[model samples]
Target: MAEPFPLAPSLWATTAPPGPETPPLTESGQADVVIVGGGFCGLSTALHLAERGIRPVVLEAREVGFGGSGRNGGQVIPGLKYDPADLVAKFGPERGERLARFAGSTADTVFDLIARHAMDVPHRRAGWIQGAHTEAGLAEVARRAEQWAGLGAPTRVLDRSETARLLGTERYLGGWLDGRGGAIQPLSYARGLARAALKAGAAIHGQTPVTGLSRSGSTWTVTTAQGARLSTERVVLCTNGYTGGLWPGLAQTVIAANSFQVATKPLSDNLRRSILPEGQVSSDTRKLLLYFRLDHTGRLLMGGRGPFREPRTPRDWAHLERIVGKLFPQLDGTAFDHRWCGRVAITQDYLPHLHEPAPGLLIDIGCQGRGVGLQSTMGRAIAQYIATGDADSLPLPLTPIAPLPMHAFHRLYVSAIIAWYRLSDGGIR
Candidate 1:
């Protein structure tokens, strides 16, 4: 078995609060709702379901926060990749606007969950800044700011000088800030959600991999690796990037791209003040983007595209370390405390998808690096739909699960695209 956690320590694992007990499932079980994967979405789904008096049984192949939920960049950014107007054009004004609005409030869903549960997760809602790497990028941020402001968001566009002052670097030409976005201790948040769900009467079993999903009459039979079975009327698959063949063709619906990250040792107060002084998280608008933030103790974390699979060595993070020095020359000699990687699910549509391929079987995929906030809200919506049996109550419209065409060669094509994007984005800082 792959170790419960990555061998190389992450900054989160070093500093996060102790997680709750999640014993493995060793016996057969029964449930009203069965949730596979114990990441943000699954835990949040269980929490919401328990709040509605529906006890859900969550089975995790490893531990909670074992996936992207624990390994993400920790930026709680809101909205999908597309702009609101574009969304309206794609899904039409009605369902499109609903999705846009829903996407816009994802950050609120996250912070609210932390506040509502009084979770012991370290977090700050200072804001999120989207730095523009070029004139075209600047135009995109301006459009984003204009549209979000029209929606009553506390959004603003910053010119080059202002961007430099706020971001501690003149690398970008301009940018926009979204006051609704923020940062959090992601692994801690995941563990907190698991705790909250357990307190609400939900059952969670870690190290219990669901090997297969089969139908037996009106019930769905969930078989785990340990030879235990869970029988339930409804089964929800929240496995995103780590999705396997539990359901044929499901994993092929999205590409699991590896995101590499590095965290520097806590900076001096002067260095910290010069960088993100107000505690805002920032990600630039580049074809191959870079996202960064400061942890509560002032450690700078940088994340972006990396190898298509799990990084094999320290050299896998050389690009990020060099880019960090370029972005903040003052930290040129700063020692890095951690280096790790995780998979981000990229859907063909660049939108979160809800799939109901069969009755009592529902699937959600395609986080696209915004899973921290998007998945939280999606979990609530999914829980609401399951509890009320009202499909219209869902914030995202359900779509059929169709595998991506030419999926097998995704890694080759994606790596080529990343290389091209890197060249276009000025070749890694």
Candidate 2:
């Protein structure tokens, strides 16, 4: 087995403004709703419910945003991994249109919340770019732009020269730009959400790992490893890729994948100006994808798929280092100051899952690396569902939790899939 890789000190952890400290749940408590997990989804749910006068108690295994919420690349992507046409084909016309509209509104939701709360996190709305890494990739980008534009999304296709100028490299054939998208300091945003939720009258507990969940009558009791429990009328489980066996079959519903990132120390002014001059965040088209952006401190962060097993050493980011070197030879010797990895859940259909296995039991999982914008938006949607008890108002249908077949072999299967993607990525390049 790979050695356990715990969350490490990341660029966001050190640079972003610190959030208010929250006390752990020491004794039993009661609230209208209990949210398990303190990442973006849980925190956002708590805030929205509190806004509706519903006191929510959020429990986190560690500090707020300790999971992929704080660890992700921080790009506020405007849509799902799949395109608008795929959504239409999958859900038919009406539902697909709603989902696509909701997807496009994610960036607006994130920035609006930040402004309403007067958050001080480093943020920018320059735009989001999806570069085409292969000849076929350019066609995919155009198709996506065309489809979303037809649906009134702020999308535009950039030819090869424009793509190269925007990204500062000729590694792409062309790309698409989503004008509604942007970037932010993820950890700072998570912390800001926590503070806002607290001010709105939500109880947030850190270091409170939920051990068991059981229902009695209409009240659901949540037991924590710290011997603290809470009884509430509803429960929202927001533990995505880091999901364990807390609730039976929840973890098996999606495959967990590792995404690793490396950040270089602040670059020189000249280098910064020459690289990604427009301040837009970008990710390329490849099975083994590459996402990168400039931090507030001028640090360049590059992210891609990591080893299926926990990284035994920092050398695991060497592949990312090679990509950076090749893409921008001027920064070939630039030293990486930070390297870390986090799990992102991927559903079979590549769409975020909204599961309601039992009465008062709700789950939102499988971000597919689009959690930064999607999670917060989904949290608010889930809160609306809990407040009004209207499933039709949600972006995605509240369906039964369907566990994958032969889930016991999921680890092996994921390993093989990663291998295939890596090989396919080489062919694309």
Candidate 3:
């Protein structure tokens, strides 16, 4: 028998507030909606749907938030992975403008939910900073700020002195600051969403892996590995990077890449004062970006791209230590206390993908490493669509699922893409 998904030994696992637990489904049952995966997306969808008096049964392969939702860097950044102007150009004027606004306002939705629910997480709304790795990168961020500012977003481009003051590092050329940004204890937030959903009458079953999906007349049937089954009028897949071949071509639509994270021992007050004095979460402008922030406990958390397979911790974390030394010379001797890695989905367009693959079947995947805010906002939109049956109210237009060409070569493609990004990061661009 296959083992259940293992809960990652991340800092969040030890620190997150207590979460709700549901036993595995043991017999046949029915619901108005069945949400696959118990990460932030699924929990948020359940919460929203239940608020509207819709009963949703959420099935988790392991525990809630066991995947990237709990293992992520915790930086609540707004917008898609791409720039706003590029989004406008790709999606067109009217559609693009709406997308840009949607991206910019996502963080607001996350913070509001946290406040309304009184979630027990370290929630901070100081801001999010994006540092430029080069002069050209600085210029690009300036343009990005201009484009978002035109849409009434609270975005500002920072010059070298300002960036250095905020980040306590002279390595960056410049950057931009989005005042709407913030950070949270990701696992706690995920659990909070589950609790909220439970309050609204959503049933969540853990250790319940959906093995098969089949349509029986007007309803969809979800078969569990333990032979338990669930019938529902609507089915939603929020598995994201951990998505498998349950539905034909669903997993093939996005590339799953590994992201590794490490946390340094708590810094002294003096050191903390010198580093990120404003407590803003930050990332850099690179093909494979570098993101870092200080947790509420004052530990400096850093994350970056990593190998696809299970990583050898010591060797993998050595790269991150060197990066910290380069960025903050004062942290030369800082010892890392925790290290972990998880998969994050990246779509071809570098944006979240919403698909209505079949009648009454919807799939939401592709986080692209900017999921904290985007996924929560998307969950609300999905619930609205389910309740009102209005496609126009969705955050992103639902499209038909088109499997990636040469899907079988995804592993090789990811390897090649990583090499290219490394080369570009090394100044060969």
Candidate 4:
């Protein structure tokens, strides 16, 4: 039962809107459903559930968006680590097609929700670019573009010249653009979701951590660290990277790795016009990828895999700073305004997991570094299944939680793998 690292002083903190008022749960009461964790998934679940006239209650360990939802790079890229064809090959046509469709349009789910709610979050939907660092990388993105285009996605392959023009960097050999993806001020989006959820009659309790839970036949009971109690017929565990031992063996199901990020101060007008001029986010194809984008205000942000343990020094972000200069030499002496990190849950098979370890309890965990869009879509699907009790309504079927063997040592190996990948990717020492 470990707590998450303290919230990082990220760029989002200065830019995001104020969180809505969320009073704590005082008296013991029963709810139609109780959701754990108040990141993107939990708030979206509460919002969608309340829209359906359900009395949902949300219990958050910290203020809303205090975890990865607020700390991530905010690139709204769709699809999973796997491609559409691979999804069909692995899960078969029936379930695979459904999963592919759900995964592909996850970005749409976020944009649509923002439009439907009129959330005043700064966002853009130009596209997401996958830069190819090697010839093989170019082939891979071309294949990805072809597969997604066949599925009617507005994806296209980019030659070397086109890539250099769009990305303002010749570091990539070539790449592809998936027009369905985009970027956002992640913390602002999370706060907006909380506002919409509260307006829809949902009850959210911030700083109320669920300490333990027990079930008796049809109902489940949860106790919080604040000495409050709640009962519900259904409980949804939306904790992703910050998951603890709230449920038996749940924390061990995925490896929570750190994704470190840095944001530069607003660039000069010439630099801004030269870098990511069209406003699409870009992530290169490397063992440990480098993802970057230009915010609407012209600040350049970059992120990548980092230390397994929480960062302890400014040196933890030196690699990203060097990589930025390598990619955009014009930014060599630019000053960085923010540096932070958050945990991203990586499942065994690199896909989102839905588990029903017990009756009347559902769990959604693991995002593989794409939580913003996937979790938003997952919330709507989980809400539909909760309201209707139809497993088919869910994008993925319920699976048993299978904790990784020797899960305690994941960090040891994960760190080693990251080191090897970093070396292979090639950069300053």
Candidate 5:
């Protein structure tokens, strides 16, 4: 067996109090719902259900937000990983408009929840800039901005000078600024969601891995590795990237890719003021994108493509450091305060999936790289679906579940494609 990756200590570790760690299910118990995975989706769903007087039991293999929910770039930018145009092409214009609205409104939902729950996750609606690193990329960014504006979003296209003024880098030609987008401390947000769920009367069990799941009559029996079992009327699988092997078919449809990030020591006031004067999170528009933002402590957190396959040691944090230096040469030689990596699930079409694998079974996975904002929206949708059996409440279209063709070859295929993109970025045609 591969050794488990070391859990990097996060700033949130010091901020939020530890959540309650319920002992693993020991004997057969019963509940209204059994939720798998304690990340944002599971926790948010539990909270919603609890509010509606439905008690839910959440089982998490690791601590809450132990997956991408806690370790993401924290860029709560709007929209899905795939383009809105593509979604419109796939689904009709009306459904596509609704999906777009859901994606765009996701940021509001996140910030609203933080406010209503008094969750101190250092959230800032500082807007976000989608930088364009090349001439073609710049044109595309302009086109996208126009499309968004036409769709009633408040987006503006910025020239090279404006881009440089906002980003403190000459690396990009131009970009788009979407005021609706923002950033947050991801782990803190996840923990806040857990606290909210707990306060709402939901039970969350950490360090409890579900070993076996079997259908018994109208109820589903969930057995934990530690000799505990729960018989529930409904089962929700919100495992996402850290799904482990619970549902093999769902796992096959999504590839777990590792994304790494490094944070520098707090920047000097002068440098911090100049880089992001407006306090907006920024990301470049490359196939393998580079995302960065100033944390609550004024440190520069930079992240990009990395660890293409499984989560393993010997991470290339140095590569991230070099990239950061290239983007801000003045920050060269600055000591990094932390380096970490996490896995994100990417689907074939680069979209999230909500599937009904069996009766009373609802599996939601594949957020690609945009789970932070979308997860909450998905949680609300799932809760409504479970409560009223209405698929129309979902944010994204619920298409038929089609597993990836030739699943075993994903690693090789993804690695090669990533290498090609890297080489292209390096000016190799």
Candidate 6:
């Protein structure tokens, strides 16, 4: 067996053993759709398809949510990773409005799923605050809030005092708040989605790695390492970051970047109250952003960009500890109980893609860092497209597959870009 990815620790390993281990495709099987990956996108698509009387078989390399879906910042934020205006500029006004509405509703879709499935993920609707690290950043947030409000979304601009009151910290200049945003225990949510999909009559096979795939006369035959195969009418690829060469062209379109997070030991009531008075998730408006929130137990969870690839040393924990202390000086001595990192799929345009490279094949990946909410919305759209073959219903624009230029040089470019952005954020531009 291949070694597991380093970023994903076994801290939140699935408590409920995966739905019995699925034997490799020794004998050929058939299904309406054969989905690859058991994360949010795959699970959500399977659940929706099952509800529509289409039972899909999901193949997983490891357990469900074993990838980035299981270990993320857990911030259920609204909107796509890119600016709506940029989307409008790329597409047009009418299509842009439609996409904007869809992006804004991503968070609502996540909450709805949690409620409908009764997923015990400790979800909350306390909203999210986009903290501004500088005055210009605060103004930019205000302008964004105004624009979103103009589009009839629930957004509010906050002043410095208001920001401090809401976040319980004076580190920020000001920011915007959207009531639709919230947080979740992501691993639990992903597992809950898997359970819900299974209850809806979808077959999820864990530890069944898809080694290869071939087109077979209007259908697809997906093969596992054990020489087992499954023929399905359609295929959906939802493997986000751990998509290690599954599809030839798929990996070229997105850059895999590492993101790290550290969780401090549960805080005392007084410290918790002094840190996050409103229990809302918060992220600063920086290129290499800092996102933090207080979990149910009042533990401060902070996450930000890690090294270009993955960190390979125990000293990475010390780096994260220093960052946490720098951000919240009051928590300098707090012991960190958990530290982990995960990969995020970033597209060239900073927007997600829902592409159909061939008939009966759908791909939904490149969520950037906004997969928590975006996955649910995109998953539903994918299910709709799979059922009706109407690509227009997708939350994002469906365009030709275009690989990023100089794909192999992404690590060097990303490193320079991140460093430049960090300097710009510090007023060095």
| Candidate 5 displacement at residue 336 in angstroms | 0.8
RMSD, every candidate, angstroms? 1.4, 1.9, 2.1, 2.0, 2.2, 2.5
Worst 10 residues of 3 by lDDT: 1-10
lDDT of 3 by residue, 15-94 (tens): 88788878888989899999999998899999999999999999999888889898899999988866777887888978
Candidate 6 Cα RMSD (Å): 2.5
- lDDT tens digits, residue span 1-429, model 6: 765456445334422233333434456689999999988889899999999999899998878887889888889998876567866887799888888888888899999999998877777888989999887897889887877787787889999899988887677888999888998888888888988888899988888899888897898889997777998879999998777787777888988888888888889888888876887898888888888898766788888776786776656656557767776677879998777887898888888877778778888888788898888788888888888877687866667778787888988988898777756664422
Model 5, 114-146: lDDT tens digits are: 999998678899898999888898888888787
- Name the candidate, 2 or 4, with the larger TM-score value: 4
Q: Rank the candidates by lDDT, best first.
A: 1, 4, 2, 3, 5, 6
Provide the overall lDDT of each model, using Cα atoms, as 2-decimal numbers. Answer: 0.92, 0.89, 0.87, 0.91, 0.83, 0.81
Can you write out model 1's per-residue Cα lDDT over 189-289, one digit (the tens) per residue?
A: 99999999999999999999999889978899999999999999999999999999988899999999999999998899999999988889999998889
**Candidate 6 residue spans exceeding 4 A from truth:** 1-11, 14-27, 420-424, 427-429
Residue 63, candidate 6: C-alpha displacement in angstroms: 0.9
Q: Candidate 2: where is the Cα deviation over 4 Å?
A: 1-5, 426-429
**71, model 2: CA deviation in Å?**
0.5
Q: For model 2, which pairs clash? A: none
TM-scores for every candidate against the unseen true structure: 0.98, 0.97, 0.96, 0.97, 0.95, 0.94
For model 4, the run of ten residues with the poorest summed lDDT? 1-10
Decide which is better by TM-score, 1 or 5.
1
Off by over 4 Å in 4: 1-6, 426-429
For candidate 1, give the lDDT: 0.92
Task: Say which prediction, candidate 2 or candidate 6, comes out ahead on lDDT.
Answer: 2
Q: How much lDDT does candidate 4 score?
A: 0.91
Residues 70-124 of candidate 2 have per-residue lDDT tens digits of: 8899899989987878888989999998899899888988999999999988999
Colliding residue pairs in candidate 4: none
Kindly list the per-residue Cα lDDT of model 4 for residues 1-429, writing each as its tens digit. 544333447899888778888777778888999999899999999999999999999999888998899889999999999999999999999989889999998999899989999998999999999999888998999999999999899998999999999999988889999999999999999999999999999999998889999999898999998778898999999999999998889999999999999999999999998998898999878879889999867899999988888877788899889888988999999999889888999999999999998998999999899999999999999999999999998888799899999999988999999998877774532
